[model samples]
Structure formats: structure tokens, C-alpha cells
Target: EAGVAQSPRYKIIEKRQSVAFWCNPISGHATLYWYQQILGQGPKLLIQFQNNGVVDDSQLPKDRFSAERLKGVDSTLKIQPAKLEDSAVYLCASSKGWGQIPGGSGNTIYFGEGSWLTVV
Candidate 1:
């Protein structure tokens, strides 16, 4: 099966600038997620979508970060007025469904190579 796809693998921008990253998840998957991974830290959940509807976004910084999954297939994440602290790898992941434990039978979450961002 094809893996998740992401674009603009690397980016550098000045603080307070804006940037958007795009993602296309694995075909047929119904759950998509966006995570922010700071250097030396685990990826943190930023938003989640079940098909075209949002499942969770409490961790998202609504004032500056926004995301959308359109038509249940592709997604986009944007950070406006980006801050130096916003520098991190933005990861796109997909799964067949929710409530499936990691490493469990027939349950796997596939991840993209991630879009790397550097705020200067």
C-alpha cells in the first residue's frame, strides 16, 4: 500500500510569517491526524479528523494554527504569524479507524516523512 504523502519537506521562514503544508493520506483510510514534533520531543497531536469532520482539536493553537481535511482525503495545516517556537516537523498520519491500539492486530498508523519547518 502507498504511504502517506507530504510536501515541502523543508521550510525556513522569519518569525511572524506564514506557511502551509499539505498532506494526502493513504487511500481508504478514514482517520487522519496532524502532529507537531519538536526537536528531542515526541510528536504532539495537533488535530484529528474522521473523514471530513473534526474529531479532536483541543491541542491546536486556534489563534495561529489551523487545519482542514477536505472531502475526507487530503489535508492542509497552516501556521500564520509563525513563531520561533512553531519550528518543528509537521507529521501527517492515517489509520483505518479509531480506538485501535498501536502495534495491535491489523491496526497500524502510517506516517508521512513530515514537513520540516524552521522559524528564524
Candidate 2:
């Protein structure tokens, strides 16, 4: 099966610029997620979707970030007017549940090499 796909392995922009990233999850996956990883820190969950419905977006910085899963297949994350602190790796992952998440192979979250964004 094809794994998750991401683009613009790297991006550089000045503070306060708008940028968007795209992701295509694996086929048959029931859940998708977007995470932000700053240099030297663990990835933080930004938004999550169960099909076309958002299941959890608790950590999403709504003030500047927004995302959507239009057709329940692929999704996009947009940062309107990016900030200097937004420089990090945007990662896309997918799992298989909207209910209590299980573990092992079923809960496997495959990462796309990541879209690295730099703000200056």
C-alpha cells in the first residue's frame, strides 16, 4: 500500500506570510492527523479527522492555523500569516479509528518525511 505523501520537503518564508501544506493519507485509513514538531521537541497534535469529521483539534492554533479533510481522503493545513514561531516540521499521519484508539499494527501512525517550514 502506498504510504502517506507530503510536499515541499522544505519551505522558507518571512514572518507573517501565509502558507499551506498538503497531505494524502494511505488508502483505507479511517483517521488522519496533523502534527507540528519544533526543533528538538516531540510532535504536537494539531488537528485530527475521522473521515470528513474532525474528531480532535484541541491543540490547533486557531488564531492562525486551519485545516480540512474535504473528501475524507486528502487534507490540507493552512497557516494564514505564518509567525516566526511557526517554523517546524509539519507531519501527516493516519490510523484506523474514531473510537478508543487501539495499539500495535492497527494504531500505526505512518509519518510522511515531513514538510519542513522555516520562518524568519
Candidate 3:
């Protein structure tokens, strides 16, 4: 049972610059999510994907942020012309499926270490 994997653990860039983060969820997981956690707040869902289709993205800032899960196996999140307010930990999480955990009543989401981004 492996855990979610994320890359470029830390990143620092000037405001208005662009950056991207990658995530590989646990094997066999069918749902993936990307979240943004600012310094003092809880993680906020940016987008969610079930397989290769997007489930929800109402919280995402579409003007500068975008994400995609290709083949339902790997996902990538990109921010272009990022703002200083966007500085935060980008968390990637996954679960077996919505209310479909084997022998479990609820779905358990597994998270990665997180990719830290700083927009200076």
C-alpha cells in the first residue's frame, strides 16, 4: 500500500510567475483531489477528479489555476501569473472512491507530504 507522491517539495517564485506541481496517487485509487492550505487555515479543495473526468472545481481560481488527471492515474496542477496570496502548501490526496471503500463504511483519503509554494 503506497501513499500519494508529489514533486518539488518546495518552491519560491516572484509574483506573476508561473509554476506547476505533479501528483501520483496511491495505486488503484479512483479519486484524486488538489487542495490549497494557507498558513492558518484548513486545506481548501481546489479541484476534484473521478477517473479522467472532473467532479468539481467550483473553488478553483480558473483565471490562474488549472489541473488535469490523465488516464485517472496521474495529475498535474498549474498556476500561471501567480499572486502572492496564492502562496501555500499544495496538497494532493486520493481515495478508493466515493463511499466505495472495501469493507469500510466511509472513504479514507490519503495525502501526500505536500508541495510548498511561495509567491514573493
- Clash number for every model? 0, 0, 0
Give lDDT: candidate 3, residue 102.
75
Model 3 ranges with Cα > 4 A deviation? 100-104
Q: Model 2, which residues run further than 4 Å from truth?
A: 101-106
Query: TM per model?
Result: 0.93, 0.92, 0.95
lDDT tens per residue, model 2, 43-67:
9999999999998899999999999
Backbone clash pairs in model 3 (N, Cα, C under 3 Å; residues 3+ apart or in different chains), count? 0
RMSD of each: 2.3, 2.0, 1.7
Candidate 3 lDDT, 44-82, residue by residue in tens: 999999998999999999999999997889999999989
Q: How far is candidate 3 from the true structure (C-alpha RMSD, Å)?
A: 1.7
Q: Pick the candidate with the highest TM-score.
A: 3
Model 3's alpha-carbon lDDT is 0.95
- Candidate achieving higher TM-score, 2 or 3: 3
**Model 3 CA lDDT for position 109:** 88
| Predictions in order: lDDT | 0.95, 0.91, 0.95
lDDT (tens digit, per residue) of candidate 1 on 48-70: 99999999999999999999987
Residue 19 alpha-carbon offset, candidate 2, angstroms: 0.5
